[model samples]
Structures are given as structure tokens and as C-alpha cells.
Target: MSRRRRLRSRMLALVLVGSLAGLTAVGGPAIADTLSDKRAAAKKQEQENAAKREQLAASLEGLSAELGQALLDLQAMEQRMPQAQAELAEAQESLDRSQREATLVAARLQDALDQEVSIGSTIEQDTARATRIRESIGQMAREAYKGGGTATSMDIVLGAKSTEEFIEQYGLVSTALRTQTNTLDELRELQAQNANSQARLEAVRGRVQELKAEADEKVVEADAARAQAQERKDEIQQLISQQAAKKAQIEDQKAAAEAEAAAADAEAAKIAAELAAIAAQQRAAEAAAAAAAGKPQAPAGPVGGSLFANPTSINPMYVTSNYGMRLHPTLGYVRLHAGIDLRTYCGTPIYAGRAGSVQWAQYRNGFGNQVMVDHGLVNGSSLMSSYNHMTSFSVRSGQRVEQGTLLGYSGNTGTSAACHLHFEVYVNGGTQDPGPLLGR
Candidate 1:
């Protein structure tokens, strides 16, 4: 906006030069044409400034909102990070527990397998011993049958040669029968022990298989827990990285915004100084006029409470942001807002706050299309009010306007985050809060 204004001022200078040249050599018609051409150029430049100002306003508006959203997202991510960490920890613990269980089950499986193998070996040995004993008994019975077919006590008595010989044979027969009976009973006991060993081997084999399956399941559980922990860890890391990026971007944007805002502030101060000088001149001119007519000066102090009415068509006006210092959330740097932001939709009608002369209805840097009203004097002080960031104005510089006269339409035309009215009140050429001065 300022650049265009400077260019326009330069163009006006060129026109002045042309006018001087025309005065010396050219006729009145050429001077008129030169003036007309300059006016056309000025209007074109003003239009271009309006376009650029609106474009700048639109582009800059979303930054504050973006910063706000980025800050919110960062805060939410910070809050979520702990929860994700806790979930990862919980998963890690689960994996550890599962691994421990898998190890124990594997150990138990090995033990059960060893036990089954031992029982099987024992069963094989018992079967071999039983078979050897049965074979020995069969060989003995075959030998007795092949030699005499009978070794009973009756046969021994019948075959005896003498009384003493018969007695010895009878004793031999009785001892042999008793030995056979004991041998058969031992074989039967060995068979029964082999059967019990086989049963125990089968039980141990089943237990070994069961342990193997349990160990496999524990291993699977451990793997699943490990995967879950890794996933959660990755999610947390990604979230942290994204939040960091957003914060950095927001900070960079805020830095740029702060710079722009500072420029706007300086511009406002310059404008205020210029207004003060103009007011001093106007006051001197008025004093001269009044003295020439022998009239008293305007009232010395405020006779009424407030000198201005609400500069808006909206009833029950609302304030969006108060005129004061605004602080950056992370930067901790302060910037002046300089004016009260009133709630006004785009194109909302803006009315004159008090009867005054319009200083300018044009774009002024970051303020966009603005209207400054110099309400001569109030409460023995120079008073002024400005309506900023308007879509368009109905009044022009030096135009007399009455209180409640339609001035312009509110807008988001310059350095605004949204559609609203930046209303400023000045007392003795210094900015003051407009809230107390504006009518309720």
C-alpha cells in the first residue's frame, strides 16, 4: 500500500513538473490535458493499490489462525506422547513376560522329553530281561523233557536202587520242583513291571508333547507383543517429528508476521504525527477566523460525556480484540494492536462516529482502505477517529460529514486475520482506547 502511495506521489510530482513546463511554453489546453492524464494515472494506481491491499490482507489473514492451529496441534501431540510411551512400555512388558514364559516352557518341555526317553529306555531293558528269563525257563523244560520226561517224587521212589539212594532222589526232585515254581513267579513279576513301565513311558510322551505346544504358543505371543511395542514406538516418534516440524514452521511464520506488524506500527506512528501537524494548522486557522469575527473560542472542556457515537451499523456491538499489547505464544515478544477490533462482517456498513471532516478515504499501508475523521476539538483537545480496513469508503478527504453519516463498508482488507473493523480514537494526536469514547 505504501509503495503504491509513494509511486502515486511521484506521479503527482511529474504532473507538477509538466504543469510548470506548460505554464512557460504550452497553452491552457495542454495543461488541462496534462492534469487530466495525471488524474487518470492516479486513479489507476489507486485501483491497483486496492487490489494489492485486498490480496495482501487475504493472504496474511490465515497466518494467525494457522499459528493457532499449529500451537493446538503441538499441545495435543505433547499430551499424546506420554500415552503412546506408556502403551509401548506396556507392550514391552508383555513381550518380556511372554519371553520368560516361553523360556520356562521350553525348559519344561526338554525335561518332559528327557523323562519320556528315560522311561522308554527303562521299558526296553525290562522287556529284554523278561525275554531272557522266559528263554532260560523254556530251555530248562526242554532239557528235562528230552532226558526222562518226568522228575516227580513218585518216579524217583520207583527208580531207586537202595533205600538211601531213594531218599536222596526224593529230596532232589522236591528241591527242583520248588526252584522251578520260584523261577516262573519271578518271570511273571518281570512281565508285570514291564507293562507298568510301558504305561509310564506313554504318559511322559504325552506330557512332552503338551509342553512343546505350550512353548510354541508362548513364543508366538512374545513375537506379537514385540511387534506391538515397535509399532507404538514408531507412531510416537513420527508424531514427535511432525509436531516439531509444525512448531518450527509456525515460528518462522510468526517471525515474519512480527516484522510486518512492526512496520505497520511505525507507519501508524508516522500518520499520527502528520495528523497532529495538520490539526495544529487547522486550529490556528480557525483561531484567526474566530478572532477576526470577535467570537469566543469553542468550549474549553467537554460539556457532554462522550463526543462520538458508535461508528457501526450493527446494534449491540461486540469487541473482537481489545486495543493493547499482544504477546507471541512461544516467542514471548509483545506487539501493540493499537486499536479495538470490532466484530464486523465483510461489507458491513460503517457510519461516521461524529461530525467531522474526512482526512482521507484511501489505502494507507497495512490499514487498507481507511477513513480518518478529524472531529475538530473536543474537551479542549484535538480529537480524531479512524475506521480502518474497509472494503470501500463513501466519503473523501476534506469532505464534511455529520454523525451517523454512512462512511464505508467494513472489511478484512489489510493485515487482518478476519473480517472486522479496526477502530482507533486519538486524543491530542495520540492513540487511545475507543471503547470509552464511543457511544454504547
Candidate 2:
């Protein structure tokens, strides 16, 4: 009975040991598979989150660039505002001066006209007096002729009685003839004076007409100048208004971008924290798996290469100018030509020279509608590219682009004299010849 009891106890202990071993094998595999599934799901979530983060980062970079550009533009506009105001003031001053001169001229003309009128009145009075004198002289001559003309003097002398009387008659006749002669001479002198006055009046009238004409011309010039000045003032005001509106728009965009960036940053931080936790858990699981399997981990893959490609698809007709010292066409002085000028028809499509982020894409002062790209690093040097005198742009600041990506269209904007592409390559913030890079 003791031997049978010992055998049953040993069999029950063996069965219990077998059941515990089977439970460990099945339950351990199930728990490992559950952990692995959880790890995979977490990794997948992490990858998705990483992709989202990358996208958000790109967007944030673009927004920052846009904000920077906006600030620069606003500053530039602010600077130009004073210059425009100064120009307007100068124009107004010139217009005012012209108007004052015109007013003076007009006053002078009125004075000349008044003098001419007064001279005309004096001439009319002189003419009337001369006519009256001529009529009186004619009447005297007719009366003398009706009274027997030259014989009247002799009859007067004969009508004297004695020698004394005859002497008196002769004296009387001589005296009367002398008086008539004096009167005729006086009338002739008056007529000559009237003729001289008329001639002087004609000259004065001509001078007055000339003065009036000059005054009219001055008034016309002043009116034109005033009109031009007004137009310029209006244009400047309109430009200021436009700049203000643009600044406001940029401010709004910047505010929205900042808000978005903040949200994205928070979300990315949350995702990073979750990823970190997941990574720690995964590392622990992997380490455990490795320990269980007694194997080593594989290495990661290699990184990709960074090389540039041609910017545009279309072949240019010819290079208009190469980078070097040359005389400027419009500026009329020796200056450094910092870029290669590529001649092409207006509205030609422009492309990116390399895969990079856009630094700026807007209307620059001298460059016109320009686009600048930041090629992070190439050939162990920081590189950048710029396209100037563009008519329009397709890309915005901080946007990522690939080689041959369309950036804009060629134009004759800003300081450009003709339609062309001004291509520049910058190395370490200094301009360099792009011929070698372009393989031209």
C-alpha cells in the first residue's frame, strides 16, 4: 500500500510539471505576438507621424521665409515712402513755382494791355484834335479865297486914306498874313505829333501782344506742370496704399502661419514623445527577441547623392552677357555684371537649377520679379542660385522644389532693358560665374 501511494504521488508531480511547461510555451508565444503586433502598430503610427512632421516642417519653413520676405518688403516700402514723398514734394514745389511765374506773367500782360488801351485813347484824342484843326484851317482858306484870295491884301492896303493910313493898312495886312501862317504851322506841327504818337502806339501794341502771348504760353506750361505734379502725387499715394494693403495681407498670413506653426509644433512634440515611448518599448522588445533568438541586428542603408541638373528644359538661343566687369547699358557706367544674361523671348518659362528650397520669390528693387533658391550645400560649399527680371513667378518663399521645376516666366521688369533671364550662382554668399556649373 505504501509503494502504490508513492508511485501515484510521483505521477501527479510529473503531470503537473508537463501542464505548466505546455502553458508556458503557448502563453509566452501568444504574449510575444501581441507585443510584436503592438510594436508594429506603434512603428507604423510613428512613421505616419514622422511623415506628417516632415510636411509640417516644410510648411513652417515656407511660412518663416514668407514672413521674412514680407518684413523685408514692408521695410523696403517704408523706406521708399519717404523718397516718394520727397519726389512728390519736389514736383509740387516746381509746379507752384511755375504757377507763380505764370501769375506774374499774367499780371504783366494785364498791365501791358491797360497801357495799350490808354495809348489808344490818347491817339484817338490826338486824331480828333488834328481833324478839328484841319477843318478850321480849310474854312479859313476857303473864306480867304472867296474874299478874292491874294487881292485881299492889296485891297486892304488901298482902302487906307493917307500915307500914315496906307502904312497902317500894309502893317495890318502883313501882321494878319503872319498870324495865319503861324496858325497853319501850328496845325502842321500838331498833325506830325499825332502821326508820331500813332506810330509809337502801334509799337507799344505789338509789345503788348508779344507779352500777352508769352503770358499765355507760361500759363499753359504751368497748367501742364500742375497737372503732371498732381498725377504723380496721386500715383505715389496709390502706391503707398497698395503697399499698405500688401503689408496688411502679409501680416495676416504671417499671423495665421505662426498659429499653424505653433499648433504643428505642439502636435509634433506630442507625436515625438509618443514615438520616443514606442521606440523605447520596441527596443526593449527587440532586445528581448534578440536575446531569445541569440542573433545580431542588421545595419542601415546608405544615403543618397546630391548633384545638380540643368535648370531649364529649352535650349537658349545664346548668352547675351557673361559674368564680369562690363559697362551697364542703361546705367551708363562701368559696373560688375554679377550674372549671365540669357536672351529669350518674353514669357519664357524659367526653371530651378537644383533641388532646393526657395528663399525668395517676389519683386526685388533692381532684379524685378526675382526668385532665389538656397541649395543647402554642394561640393562642400554653401550654394545659391538666383533668377531675375522675371515677368511672373509660380513658386513662393520657402517652397521645396526639384531641378527643372518651373519658377517663373522671363520679362523686362525692374532695371532690365530687354526681355531676358539673369541667371546668377552664389557660392558662400559671393557671386561666381555660372558657366562652369551650367557646363556652357
Which candidate number would show the highest lDDT if scored against the true structure? 1
Model 2 lDDT per residue over 4-68, tens place:
34433433332232111111111111112376785775576457554443322212121344553
In order, the Cα lDDT scores of the candidates are: 0.71, 0.61
TM-score per prediction, in order, is: 0.49, 0.46
* Per-residue lDDT of model 1, residues 320-369, tens digit only: 66667666454466666677777778898999988989988888777878
The runs of at least 3 residues in candidate 1 whose Cα sits more than 4 Å from the true structure, single-residue gaps closed, are: 1-73, 162-171, 236-251, 260-327, 334-440
Instruction: Give me the overall lDDT of model 2.
Output: 0.61
For candidate 1, give the lDDT of residue 76.
58
Which 10 residues in a row give candidate 2 its minimum summed lDDT? Answer: 19-28
Q: Enumerate residue pairs that collide in model 1.
A: none
